[model samples]
Target chain A: MKAKVIVKLKEGVLDPQGQAIQQLLAQRGYSQIADVRVGKLVEFELENVTPIEGEAMLAEIADKLLANPIIESYRIESQ
Target chain B: MSIAVITFPGSNCDRDCLHVLQNVIGAPARFVFHKETDLGDCTGVLVPGGFSYGDYLRAGALAKISPIMPAIHRFADAGGPVLGICNGFQILCEVGLLPGALMLNRNLRFISRWVDLRVENSDTLFTRHLWQDQIVRMPIAHAEGNFTVEPETIAKIVAKQQIVFKYAGPVREDSPDGNPNGSTLSIAGIVNEAGNVMGMMPHPDRASEAILGSTDGIPIFRAFAEAAQEKSRLEYSY
Candidate 1:
């Protein structure tokens, strides 16, 4: 089994990197960019794990390694 | 007073922190490697500044997940004092030890300069030696020091008096214009809810010595030492 975790800054939190990228795109004449937010995608490969177990493992990873709960949130999906 | 300074692979300020704590403060402070599991008999832990792991993914993204952090977290949860400075601060935030997040400078530039900070709350062990509203000069060098959180969370932080330091003077009057980095509310540092852990973007260790152009950082260490002493006394009173 494989799991993918998508981490993003929580709402109302400032995304400076996203804003910088947006600015760069605008400068490059890609003005159609209405919004841009940067996030991280982490993939995990596991064997003999159920979806629930995978989710629990991903939560552990998010809390202990992948995401900083103070400002980032994560979603886990199994494949 | 034994102090442990955690040193990640790319940490450049571990020696500086060790020097200040050992020489100036006369404390037994040692540099602990990131891969080290033992914290020894240290009473307090100091996460010094510098680009840990070259700040590959994020300012402190990788360093926070190092093998030693779980031990650091256990130490902190046991009511131990932990001070995170600059890159250390970012690691704390990245590890969820502190609230809020540090984003890239609003100007999108790497900032390296000395700025004045106003002491907001001096009740913590980290700031007890300083008077309220006391101004101190410290150097900040980071590309992502701009702090941000939800408005409700900001209000909660203010209500809990978690905010410890804010930029002083007109230099950081406005987020984007004044300070080299555009920090929200011009926040320089803050303590965790438990008050035992603190994370700040400015390098207080850098300002501890007179030869470093400023000695304003002395009171912070003094306060921590005094607080530790007081706590020890209280614990033994029983």
Candidate 2:
């Protein structure tokens, strides 16, 4: 089994890296950029756990380690 | 007692911090590896800077859970002095020992230069030697140092005087110290609610010597050394 966690900076937190990329694209004639927010995807390989167990553990991992609640949020997708 | 300069894998500033403690401040210090579970006979904990865990996931995220961290927590719980500089600061925040999180610099660039910081709260054991609102300069080298916190938390930080230093004075855009990192309230350093732990983005250890261009960093280290020594003495006095 496998699992994934998508971590994103909170809605109002400044995403400077994303903004820089958005600006870079604008310079290359890519217009109509409303907003660019950056985030990270973490893929994990799970062993011998049912999908429910995997999701439960992933939630704890995301809450405790993968994402910092202060500035970021994480959503887990189990497969 | 000695200051335990924590060395996570890839920590580049551990030596600098050790130098400041052992040589400059005349305080005993030793290196404690991240894999170690005990902090040994140390009264002070110094979490130095560098790209720990290669800044993966987040700057200080992985290093926060290092084996040595639980000992640090125990030490901190006993009112021990724990100072985190640069990457160390991020680790403290990641571990929830301090409030706020450092995000990418607002300009999307790695800033490495001196920053003008005004001492905000001199009451902490970390900042006792410095006076309130005294402007000091220290080298800040980092990419993700723009500290942020929830809106409601800012009020508590201000009210409780958790903020220890703030970027202030005239900031020039064309100078070597140009480009502010956009930290909330311009905070450069902060102490926890108990004032036992402190975290700051700048390198005070790098500035502890006069020949390094400024002696302002001495007072900060000196204050912590004295405080840590006092705490150790208190523990043994019983």
The prediction achieving the highest TM-score against the true structure is: 2
User: RMSD of each candidate?
Assistant: 3.2, 2.2
List candidate 1 segments past 4 Å from native: A1-3, A44-56, A77-79, B169-179, B229-238
Expressed as tens digits, the lDDT of each residue in A1-79 for candidate 1 is: 8889999988766777898889899999999997799999988899888888878988987777777666778888887
Tens-place lDDT per residue, model 1, B1-238, is 5678999999999999888887898776788899987676667788889999998867898987688888888777777788999999998888878888888787778888888899999899899888999989989888888887767788988989999999874455444345557666778899999899999998888899888899988888776655544444223211
What docking grade applies to model 2?
high
The share of true interface contacts that also appear in candidate 1 amounts to 0.52
Error of 1 at B105 (Å): 2.2
Q: Which CAPRI tier for candidate 1?
A: medium
